[model samples]
Structures are given as C-alpha cells and as structure tokens.
Target: MQETPFCLRVGHLLPYSMLDSNITNFTKTSTFILLGIPGLEAAHVWISIPFCTMYAIAILGNFTILFIVKREPSLHGPMYYFLCMLAITDLVLSTSILPKMLAIFWFNSREIDFSACLTQMYFIHCFSAMESGIFVAMAFDRYVAICDPLRHSITLTNPVVAKIGLAVVLRGIMLILPYPLLARRWPYCRTSIIPHSYCEHIALVKLACTDIRISSYYSLSVAFFVIGLDVVFITMSYTQILRAIFSLPTKDARLKALGTCSSHLCVILAFYIPTLFSSLLHRFGHNVPLHLHILIANMYLLVPPMLNPIIYGMRTKQICNRLLWLVTRKGT
Candidate 1:
C-alpha cells in the first residue's frame, strides 16, 4: 500500500501557518483557505454550545445598547454619540466573523472565497480602527467636560462631533483598504492554510513567499501611529480630567465628574490593556503553549463588546434606566 499523506500521518498537529508561507509563494492561486477554530471537532459540544451562546450574547448586548441610545432623547450628546458609534462598530465586528465562524464550528465547512475573505478582513479592520478612533474622541469629550465645563458643549457641538465621526470612518477606510488590495496582488502559494479564525495581517504575511518585511513594517507603523497615538491622547485627556475633578470645590460635583468618566475609562481599559497585553504576549511569548496564547487572543478581541454595554449602563444612568424600562416594558 502507498504511504499515507504527510498531513494525515501528522494528524494535522502542526500549525496551519506552515502552509501559509508556502501558499504565499504559489503563482497560480490568488485566493487562500482558512482553517478555523483549530481543534473543534464535529462531535465537540463543549466548544459549539458556548461559542454559539457567546455570539448570541454579543449581538443582543450590542443591539440593546443601540436601541437604548437611539430611543432616548436624553442620551443625545457627543459622548453618547460616540457610544452609539462604538456599539455599531461592535455589532459590525462580531457579526463579520461569528456567523461564518459558527458555521465552521457547528458544521465542517472551512471554505471561504477569496473576495469574501478580503471583504471580511476589510470590515474587521475598519470597525477596529473606528473603535480606536472613537476611544480617542471619547477621551476628548471627557477632557472638555471635566477641564472646560463652561465650553464643553461649544467645543463638542453636535455638528463638530458628526464631522469627527465621518472623518474617522473615512480615515479608517483609507488606512486599511490598501492592505487587502496589496494582499490580493501577491499570488498565493497553492497549499497554504491560515490557522486563525480571521485574516490577520501577521498571519497572512507569514504565508507570503515574497519578503513581507515591507508589509509587516507598514502594518506595525500604522498600528503604532493609530493605536499608540490614541492611547497617548486618551491618557493625557484623562490626566487632565482627573486634575480638574480633584480641584473642584463640592464633593458631589467631583464625585459626579468621576462617575461620568468611570464607564468610559472602564471600556477604555478593557479595550486597550488587553490589546497591548496580547501584542506583548504574541511578540515575547511565542514559545508558550498555543492554547494559552489563543485564550489571550480571543479575550483581546471579544471582551470589548461584552464590556461596552456594561460600561454604558453603569456610567450613564439615563441609559441604564432606559434600558431597564425598555426590558420591563417588553416583558409587560
């Protein structure tokens, strides 16, 4: 009898990334294949049930936030406007991959078309960039509200905030669009498989036959400029906000100021800390076990959506009250 296939004999234990670099080298195939949810077997109930439930929760949680903000007139402000944008971005981010991911997890299909994969990658980056931008914007809102209360409304007018929102979308599109296009231009090798659930820049580049140093450098540079700068601005904004609040005369006013900022700060911490942590873990701890790395990776991606609504509900009393009323009314 002929020897078994090398892939089969190995029981597919090697990282799918081994095939990625090979695939990037191929001249004939323009598209790539993704091997999703690494170890989830068809018979595995533990993974499927929980994964499905998490996706459902993410959608419902974000949708409820969207509804609460849209329905309540009191929630209309630059801060809440950014909150709504954040909610929308969360919805887009989770929905972009979860349905397809669920299909693969529940069923056994892993075939994603080239164009579709690129589209998914684009929106994933788009919303992620938008979220980063809005976080920065939220910091500014907080800064004005705390540091320059008299001019807060004037500084963050509805029109001005709207323009900021539009600019963020356009800039995100500009920043990320070139990546997927550049990705497509490079001919993929015939036999590569993406190990991750989504088309991450590093994961994709690892498979490239050509030197992806330029692409890697470009991605890192953009990430540093975008995410790093946002973090700096947010930190600075909050530092000023804290200083202003402490200097206030009334305990009640100071408490209120801190409370107003608390929720945004929670969401910001949840979003940024995990992101920075995961980056460090990936870069410095590659020798660690795959399961541990994947856990951190998923947390970095998924926790923001889970915590966003919680932050909104806790920090913005109007939102919490309205959401409670809505739920109670629906039940009635």
Candidate 2:
C-alpha cells in the first residue's frame, strides 16, 4: 500500500536526524585526547626508555635529599628546611606529568578527561610557581646569612621559616587557581586532541572555542607579576649580598661569602633559562617545530628536579659527606 512506503520513509529519516544531533552533542562533552610528543609514534617505545631512566633518577635523588635532611639533627636549619620543601615540590611536580606521559607512550592510553586535565594543569603550574617562590625565599636566606651573619640566627628562626614555607604554598595556590577555573567555563568545540604531551595552561587554552585573549593576557600577567616579582627580588637580594661580600676585609672572607650562594644561583639558572626560552618560543615563535617545543617543555619540568639533588650534593659539603657515609656504611 502507498501508506506503508510513506511511513517507512519517515521512520528511516527520523533516526538519521537524531544521529546528527547526537554527533554534534558528543563533541561538546568529550574527553581530551593528549597527543604525546608529535611525530614520535614510531619511536615512542625507544624514547620512553630515557624518560623512564630520568624519572627514576629524579625520584631517587629527591627522596635521598629528603631523608638526609630529615634524619640529621644538625641539618635542622632554615636553609635545609627550604631545601626539603623544594625536594617535596619537585617530587609532586615531576610525578604529576611523567607517569601519565609514560602511560601515553607505553600503552597509547592518552585520553584525559576534562577535569583530570584541568587538575593536572593546575598542580603543574602551581608547583612551578611555588618553586620560584621558594627560590626567592632561599635567596633571602642567603642574603641574610651573608649580609647579616651576626643576626641570621635570631632572624630566621623555626617559626619564621615555617611562615615563609606557608606563604610560598599559599601564594602559588592563590595565583594559579583562577587560571584553570577561568578556562573551564569555555566550551571546547574544536577537536579535543591536545598537541602536547601534557596539559599545559596555554596548550589547553588553544583548544578552546571562545576567544582566548583574556586567558592569554591573564597568563602573561601572572608570569610577569608573580614570577617576575620573585626574579626582581632575587636580583635585589643578591645585589645586597654582593655588596656585603665585597666589603669583607680579606679575599678569603669574600670568596667564602659569595661561594655559598653559587650552588643556589646555578639551580635557579638551570630552572628559569630553558623554561623561559621554551615558553617564549611557544607563545611567539609561529614557525617552531612541534617536537622541539614538546622537548623543551619536558626538559623544563624535568631537568631541575633531576639536577637539584646532584647540585646540592656536590656543593653542600654536609650533605655530600652524609650521603657518602651512608653509601660506605651500607657497603660494609
């Protein structure tokens, strides 16, 4: 009958129309696919080997620093307290990224849910900013030790150091918390696949459907005002330290005063310089290769955590001897 054919056409068309709507809706609520290290699909297995090795080194090194500082009664000073906090922050920062990265490379498990990605981005940036603050605090510690050695003990007592640590943690959380929350309100109507290994602030913002001008401006503001403020204070602190060091009567005295800060200065340089280079390039360099940007980003998070312990071990006589003693004692 003619009625039978007409009814069949309407029924068939109905599901097709629904299917189109469903597909449109799916993109709005989908998980973000993280593309780990672009153009490295064929070599992912090989590349993960070094990443795994470096992660192992970072973990072992930072844990050892924590243990050495905690067990030794004599090491319970403001400087060592700051170092312990740094080690812990490094642990958190490195763990937040590397495990997920390994999973992506080794198992091809790269689908990160929206909330998880936002959480990861928050912690990564928070700890990074916290580390900068800790460095500034460390610079202040060094300045007090060198410039006002006579009153250093009275000035940076246990309570004072505890307050500094609290301030650093609070500062980072307060400054970075708004970033992800601001980003989350926008709908990501574009492809959900992220081009980087991990969910970084700017990288995630790029995938948004709305205008990211405010996000971009706010991010730059945080960098210049929060991180930049730390850098400026550090420079000023060191300026005073240098002035005090030069006024010392003997060559030996000046050398000794300045030498104490040399290790911390090196760590700061190692952290900021490469990271700054990569971030500037990512934001401004339109033609930079994807793989290169990814590599530098990885290094920025990794190298300092891996190297901080090694640098401190070599430069801080007390720590080096303690570690050496532990090793030899274990061998015996």
Q: Which candidate ranks first by lDDT, i.e. highest?
A: 2
**Model 2, clash count?**
0
Runs of candidate 2 exceeding 4 Å displacement = 1-29
Candidate 1: what lDDT? 0.75
RMSD score of candidate 2 (Å) = 8.4
Q: Per-residue error at 301 for model 2, in Å?
A: 0.3
TM-score of each: 0.88, 0.91
lDDT of each: 0.75, 0.85
CA error at residue 279 for candidate 1, angstroms: 2.1
Tens-place lDDT digits, model 2, residues 20-84: 33222223346877879877678888988988887898899999999999888889999999999
Pairs with steric clashes in candidate 2: none
- Write candidate 1's Cα lDDT for 51-81 as tens digits: 5676677778888888877888888889889
Off by over 4 Å in 1: 1-31, 39-45, 330-332
